[model samples]
Target chain A: MPRENPLAPVERELRVAPRHRLDLVNEVDADVLALQAELERRGYGPAEARRAAVARLVPGGRVIRQLEDRHRPLLGRRVLASGWMDRAVAVGAGAAAAFAGVVAVVATASPGGAGMTAAIRWLLVFVAALMAANLGRAAARLWVQGDLRQEERQLLWARQTGLIVAAVAAGALGAAWEGYPVPGTSVGAGGPAFVPQSAVWEAIGSVAGVAVVGLAVAVFGLFGWLLVTPRLITDEECERRIDDFFAQSRPRLTPDSTKAQSHAQ
Target chain B: MQVTLSKRINELLVLAVLDQGPAHGYQIALAVEEQTGGSFSFQHGTLYPILHRLEADGRLRAEWHGTGRRRKTYEITGAGRAELAAGAAELEVQFRALLGLLRGCHAA
Candidate 1:
């Protein structure tokens, strides 16, 4: 007699079972299809709709929660009441930047102002330090939330590290520009004429400085925009987004299929 | 106008849909949307959890059926029907009260 197939019994049981829980694979596929259809109905092209559908299904993490929370205080609140604090902060930052710019210009215009130059240098360092501290605090909060997976945590750490490194590089370039030595040219003369090597370092340092300033300006603009923009999502919308994320991210398995597969193995 | 459904109202909506007969998730969603004149769109995340919760509470029964790919369908229980009736009554009372207030405002 031929050896009996061990998989036969499990397959039989699966066939006999009247009801089974919906497995994750089918669940995700159905949800994605539904989302895609909905998005397409809203005038998104097929590709764009699919991409959006996938993004909606991504698993929830600390980063996502943080982003969602950033919008929460504005939701369902009176516009004036919800935004006053952020508007105040943005106005204060703009004033500080304007004051710093004026001070730097005045210090540069002063005659034989070695001291003023030193103060300018200190100001740059102070700004860099402030940026670093703020970035670190934000990163720390994200970490403390502890909802991130290992990969997400690593990605966040890598991004923060890159920003810190860039800030340090910018600060160093600024300092180098301030102290760049003059190169001596031997013109037939009473003394060697020293030309300040500020041109090259100044260009490089200015680029870095502009980049940092632009980032700060962009952040301030974002804050202002957030303060002004009406709330985009209701509580139901938020809950829906969160649910889609989890539904997409979590693993799905059916018991009977697993048993059947295992028996076949 | 878009009507925002509270959690209880959403639950009642699901129960009312199932009261017609057994229906799969997608079908139920379609039914609700159609009944509301496309004003109500239920996301999978919102709908599935509610269905599972109802099943867990013995207010609904879920069974999988299909040949190639299984689909989970739900049927309303007696408890679910009772809850639906109570919710509809409550909603009717509140809606009438609001309507009366609006009429009073118009009179004033």
Candidate 2:
């Protein structure tokens, strides 16, 4: 007869949902036990074999999180849940908000006329892109499942995008300097095309403008890159974190197993 | 050495091994660890996500060996073979680029 999984207690503690329990998994139980048996045959003491087997597991919290992508709740239900879903829903609900922000831009601007409007429009795109990217990062965290390396790459992408936008903002400021009407009264004509003061984005003030698939799309694209390029972690600190953070939840070693190990030794 | 692998490499490596024949997770983990001389070790549990993801992505298929232990044996699908081929080609290109870059630095 099959034995109870060694990890049932840990599973209970984690309250791994019924849907994911199958995956929690019987395979792991079998593997750990089989490895333990093999180790004992090879003259490893019971405790030593048990330790060796336990060390092979991923970790507890991570097992549930990693499988989240596979066992994600149904769409309508998922959006109702908080956290990353809120980020996704906020982006989804943004069409109405985008319309309102457009109205705000229309109502708020002084008679700085078409020049200010044009400058504001470009600036709007820049600021909205940044906000959406920052907010959407929460969602990407779900996709990465706490892989610091992926998080590192995501942060790098965000910084690069910020720089590119800044470069374009500089050019726009230059145009405004040439009497092209930069976004704000702060940027008086011929004053500096690039205002050294106040974020060039200050122009999007009162504009709740944000919502785009760019950062998340880029994150997904990065996964494609990640699949082909492997970065091996050899650093002790980094490896330990990855090991601790990415492992499957496993059953605690039983006192009985320890005793067997001691007796064998 | 207990090196940590990015999911990218893990998927490709698992698919490459599965392509040889269907095997359980333990078998796959052992095979890779042994073959790599301990350089590409997995914490055993880490391999499951990649296995399940590939299965979800339709690149691999899994079946239970028996109900008692429920040992899952995974095999690469046609899509998996195609992915393995493409990924292997890309890795080769990267390896060559890395080698050339290092060589240039040495020559300098």
Candidate 3:
């Protein structure tokens, strides 16, 4: 014979109320009964197991705050690790994409010259801009999520602002200098002469480009390095350190003779 | 006797319970309470978050089962089992130190 549903009446009643705490309580009670049975099977005495099951019968709201507080530190560590891993992966993928772009530029430049150079320059600018935007977003997210004090947050913001201002000034200066005429280049009677620019300006542009790329590389490399370095202090070690710190601060009783000597002094 | 649940110990307990076989959230909580002889009480809200975190860490696999009232069932992975063993060892060391501290306090 098919077993009758014990909760049929409760379900019907729930249909009328729809969103009631009483329905939640009933569901929790059922779960507690199931837990009690499992506890008995594991060799806990019936009364003791029932007590444990009953403890969970309280409304979830009352206990959630305590649970979150207890687990916050552990959760924080996990979040930090996850964020670092994400940054490392993003950096790795970005580097690979940049390398592919360079290869494509080389292949395309072989067929055409002036037009290709201009296209490549624009492509480079686009890639650099995209990379900067991505880094900015990542840094902002990290700062927002971080459990930093007010002063630390202000310091970080200032440093980031300085970095942005410096980068913009350098880029603007480089762009302006890039359009300067070559030292020997002059206009011919028929048309303009195509003389290669001064080695000095070319060298400066090369240095500027290298500096920008190097900065990006350095930032990504730091994150990648952190990802690979084995953790010096595991959770267990941290716990032990905390315990030891407390133990050291705990008051100790001196010997009676020592106490007397101190009192006499 | 009521005992505060250590996050590390609670994780091991969850993994250990699932090691027996695949089980749902309520069942895991039951097994943990029973095994600890009611000393450790874990609420549904507390257990679910830990389960979700363990799943994210790839220590456990979760799948929704049942109809109408869908239930989430969990199973331990190899990584979880390895972690349980490591946690047990670490707990042993912690307990030993704690016992010594308690004994010294009593003597003093």
TM-score per model over all chains: 0.34, 0.47, 0.35
Model 2, range A30-75, lDDT digits (tens) per residue? 6666666556767888778777766675345576456555545445
Descending-lDDT candidate ranking: 2, 3, 1
Residue lDDT tens for model 3, A176-196: 443343333345333566445
- What C-alpha lDDT do the candidate models reach, one value each? 0.49, 0.55, 0.50
Cα deviation of A230 in candidate 2 (Å)? 44
Give TM-scores of the second chain, every candidate.
Answer: 0.83, 0.87, 0.87
What level of docking quality does candidate 2 show?
A: incorrect
User: Which residue pairs in candidate 3 collide?
Assistant: none
Question: Could you tell me which 10 consecutive residues in candidate 1 chain B have the lowest summed lDDT?
Answer: B64-73
The CA lDDT at A178 in model 3 is 39
**Residue runs of model 3 more than 4 Å from their true location after superposition:** A1-59, A62-265, B1-5
Cα displacement (Å) at residue A128, model 2: 39
List candidate 2 segments past 4 Å from native: A1-6, A13-16, A58-60, A74-84, A87-265, B1-5
Lowest-lDDT window of 10 residues in candidate 1 chain A? A13-22
Q: Which lDDT tens digits does candidate 2 get at residues B1-108? A: 242436667888899888888877767887788887898977736777788889988999988765333466789999999999998897889789999999999999
| Steric clash pairs (candidate 2) | A47-A261, A56-B43, A58-A247, A58-A248, A59-A247, A59-A248, A59-A249, A60-A249
lDDT of 1 by residue, A94-210 (tens): 655564575455434433235433454445434444444443333322222212223443454454445445544444554454444323222333475744466555544544453
